[model samples]
Target: MIEGTDNVSREAAAEAAASSNAATILPGATIGILGGGQLGRMLANAGSAMGYRFVALDPTPDAPMGQVADQIVAAYNDRDAARELAARSDVITYEFENVDADVAAMLMSESYVPQGSELLYTTQHRLREKRAIEAAGVQVAPYSEISSVEELREAVERFGTPCVLKTATGGYDGKGQWVIRDSSESDEAFATLSKAGTQLVLEQFIDFAMEISVIAARSSKGEIKAFPPAENIHVENILHLSIVPARLEDSVLREAERLAIRLAEGLGVVGLIAVEMFVTRDGELYVNELAPRPHNSGHYTMEACRTSQFEQHVRAVCGLPLGDTALLSPVVMVNVLGQHVEPLLERLAVRDEAAERLNVAPKVHLYGKKDAVYKRKMGHVNVLAESTEAALDWINETKIWKV
Candidate 1:
């Protein structure tokens, strides 16, 4: 990973020097957001509530994030757009990590891109991300680099079968990656990312008992706060569900938190850092990967927490102290994916809200997306229960999402 932000540090420090309040962003200040997705929309909502305006930069003007922001700049990576956005905003932050560092750097050079663009340079590339995680004293799966057929063959021979070959950069939601179950799948895996050339890593298959993620935020001043760990389930490489307070041993839970703080401190990272980890059958924690922004796993925090991650994100980027990261209720979040437009309650047959139902479930959050395709993130429902089993039952009944 990129060790230090030599050039980007000056801008981050300057932006940190400009703001220090945590409760709210100053009125009328425009906060420039890099990506125009649901995360950006939530940030815009929180900013508006705080009397702050927002300018969103995205290639797709129709993206959900821009719908709520004050102004939309219809350019994703255009340096010219970055200059214009930087000129109008008091500070800038990104909702997505895929924002071009050069473009982000351009904005920072001119005005402010709080949190700096250094983290993105490392996270946008998987190889650097793995390196960073390991450097922070975390154990990653056994892996090797692959740039050619010879390299792939070597990696396969060295790491053995059932290894996953993934793009070293720009792969997400099951994209730009492959799981090689046997030697039979090697040729196809090579053909898939042939266009990407040398940007690939061969990872060892873990006999993992569970997958967990830590969504933590770090202010530009180096103060850090992390949300409770959440367990995740994936189907076809896309997130299927997430349950907070994942059924883990106390020692393991403490270890997860320790690893998270170590990683944030090691990177000197600013803003939200979501570290995905694998817990082996032997009760060992292994670093799976890292996402340097509000992660999909933390989406449940929107309703389950005292302060949503989006709000905390702004606080961190603005150099404010993070709010209390406590869980008010035992929440289990279920994803409403695929092509079903049924309101989640109706879909789950949960109707009457008159006399306060005793066995009532949790809250639901639906992204305002029009089209609903298979595996598409239409929305999600958060179920608060007296026990995990009760919540799981409700989730199973509500699983009639788009097939």
Candidate 2:
């Protein structure tokens, strides 16, 4: 089990203590979700099985979560709709960090939002997120705030070539970022990104051995539990695969879990927080980013761990005891992007034959998305095996992804 820190601030400790005394929301309560994406769907599915009802708010009429839970088809900033959801729910939580911070703050003011808006506000913006991580006694890649092309060039000179420039807010899955491999590229990158009219941050790229994530769950009572580290691989900046029991030394993995729990305490998170970090060749861990909700890298936990992250999130927000996060198997979870959906469906149609040909049976999950646009996340497949290598080998043999 992962141990939490003793260094939390007095105010945070008091908040946790007070929250601990608050009423524990049992099953058969309504859970209000702020976003109606796949995470919301999965959370509803998990909570529904435990006898809880769910209401989701999203702009799309046919949002994925709408298929499983009661959905409010309205813009995230629609105050009336948010109010209606709050009135109908016993507690409110968001599935994604990009939800409007002001809306979250409004919900917190009038409803039972276990995961407060402060964490949401801090994480949605890259600059604030990095500073918060550093303030938590965790190290992040060296970075400088940039406001103009000149500042960008100066930062490039200071950090050297191969630095990254990213928008302060609103970008994910490889969007809203530019890699400046040479000083000459700074102006162009700046000019292109600055048009978005948002503040930018310049980060010194780290030459890390591997990227890993620790999904930590913290209840309002301050109880914390972290799942096993997941070694992640990305293709074009989008997560492609997450392998459990990250291929790192035990000591490093322990340090990563410790840091994650510490950060959760520092931020006063009441639900799941996925901490992405870079492990240097020298075994140093540097926090890369934070998601105050379920993360793509944590998809492996649905089938690999004793408790899925979805169920854990529900427990954390509803003031229930955190479930055991022990790893039950060595697993590899490969994403099925939009382009691969048809091929995956074809394979699924001949399940027995495909399993025989590949010599492995992978548990496939498809989000009920209507369209299959290129690069869009359609679903994922979890391959549990005696070894992660064997699972990865099966994924390769299938030739679904380049691996």
In order of appearance, the predictions have TM-scores of 0.89, 0.96
Worst 10 residues of 1 by lDDT: 351-360
Q: Please name the candidate that would achieve the greatest TM-score relative to the true structure.
A: 2
TM-score, cand. 1 vs. native: 0.89
Residue pairs in clash, model 1: none
Show pairs that collide, candidate 2.
none
- Best model per lDDT: 2
Q: How accurate locally, in lDDT, is each candidate?
A: 0.78, 0.91
TM-score computed on alpha carbons, candidate 2: 0.96
Q: If candidate 2 were superposed on the true structure by all CA atoms, what would the RMSD be?
A: 2.7
**Model 1, range 199-279, lDDT digits (tens) per residue?**
888898898999999888888766888898899988778787788778999788888888888888778677888999999
Off-target runs (Cα >4 Å) in candidate 2 are 1-9, 352-359
Deviation from native of the Cα of residue 138 in model 1, angstroms: 1.8
